[model samples]
Target: MPNRIEYYNFVNGGYFWHHASGETYPLGILVDQGDVLSDRQPHGKPAGTLIIYKDGNVAVKELLSIKSEKNVWFAISGCTILPKINMTAAGFTGVYSDIGRTTLRPVIGYRKKDKKIIIAVRPSSSITRAQITLKNLGCDFGITLDAGGSTALQVKGKKLHNTTRRLNNVITW
Candidate 1:
């Protein structure tokens, strides 16, 4: 599949950030051929990061040791709200305690057996609930993506959900 970053200014009917800056930004990092297009430093340590290699391989890094190298094709960062490392759900109860505050939520997970990335955009869910869902989906590792109004997912040419806000960046398969 071809991977490229596409910019959008409006979603669901509102501008991203509620400002008309006319400049599009990625909600997460965008790396192409090891070139870092954009990397949003996590507020603290990222909840998790999904790394896509140039050789068409994918991995979910749960620790804080992420680095940019020549083989990394893409990297998107998100608060590790629910880390299912080692097949155990290690939940986070810090600044992202709004796990019950449901809205549009996006999550990235790794199915160890298939060695594939599982991207899901939930209509309404909290981090805790999302973690459980990921676990049930057999994700050995998972991380919550930038959600709320920024939550969005598109398959083929059809949008899974609609948001009024535009996004700075997007990760595509």
Candidate 2:
């Protein structure tokens, strides 16, 4: 869980946060170091995956399109949070219904132009507002890892935000 970030034994200090709100037992796809950790569902339904390659490139792809490539370092699945149909805020809520609700959320994004990854937590924001935030931050694509009580963020062993709800998975450096 994201709250346990401080307990990890990492060589270089980095950030940690909640990754996904999916079921813990396994339903969608999850991969680590080229190993398929879970794939009960085989395909991610209404979900997007954050792929981190061993070479350090990142991409947000649909779950159905993912493969356990040799160079893939890790992959985390979650709901798409930005780039709605036609790139309009009005259509953003159509992708995920829960995102329409205003609440705290943890997000991960990528800026294709500059090859930057954006990770953040937004408080009391709707999907539309969160999309706007991501766009303002220069993100071309993004996904909402978790929301509400599951939202969390930590950096350098210190928590910038903490959640009361226990998390099933988390992303870290």
Candidate 3:
């Protein structure tokens, strides 16, 4: 998590939360000011979502589709929580996987209705439940960042969730 001085540097600060996790470096492709910080190759298929910040706007895109680096002020990746799937009247049953065991999740969500980006921390939940929560929150798409002991969230300088593990990436505003 960022300290007081570091958090103050953000132009439009509102929410501050841990974004990604690693020991010595970030796990995904981290971009700052159009500079590629870490291009760590993914192990299997691109299952991450790229959270991008550009022109004072935030966009969440699939890791595989983001090919261009133009105007990318800052970028980070997180595990895909809500994959592209047809939402029928029943529910998102097809995407309910038991892979992600119950745990705290830091999420980034995108509402297609207004093209708004949301940064929130979900309570101890599975990936399926987290996806459902975001879907209920009107998020069309979302991703889960490093969770468990690395999960952290702060709103308006007040610590909501703080972890002992060191954080590698954080998103402000």
Kindly give the stretch of ten consecutive residues in candidate 1 with the minimal lDDT sum. 9-18
Residue-level lDDT of model 2, residues 15-117, one tens digit each, is 1234465334444457778787665322324356677898998877665434544588777665566675222221224554554578976777899988887
- Taking all chains together, the TM-score of candidate 2 against the true structure is 0.71
- Model 1 agreement with the true structure over 140-167: per-residue lDDT tens digits: 7766766687666667766676555445
Q: What global local distance difference test value does model 1 have? A: 0.57
RMSD of each predicted structure: 6.3, 6.3, 7.1
Each prediction's whole-model lDDT (CA):
0.57, 0.61, 0.59
Task: Give per-residue CA lDDT, model 3, range 1-173, as digits (tens).
Answer: 43333562122211123445533456566776777766552432344555556666666564533455468876666566665422221122345332266887777778878878777677777767778878888987776666666677777777777766555667777
Roughly what TM-score does model 3 have, to 2 decimal places?
Answer: 0.70
TM of each candidate vs. truth: 0.68, 0.71, 0.70
Name the lDDT value of residue 103 in candidate 2.
Answer: 90
lDDT for residue 63 in candidate 2, whole number 0-100: 55
Give the lDDT ranking, best first.
2, 3, 1
Query: Relative to the unseen true structure, what is the C-alpha lDDT of residue 135 in candidate 3, on a scale of 0 to 100?
Result: 87
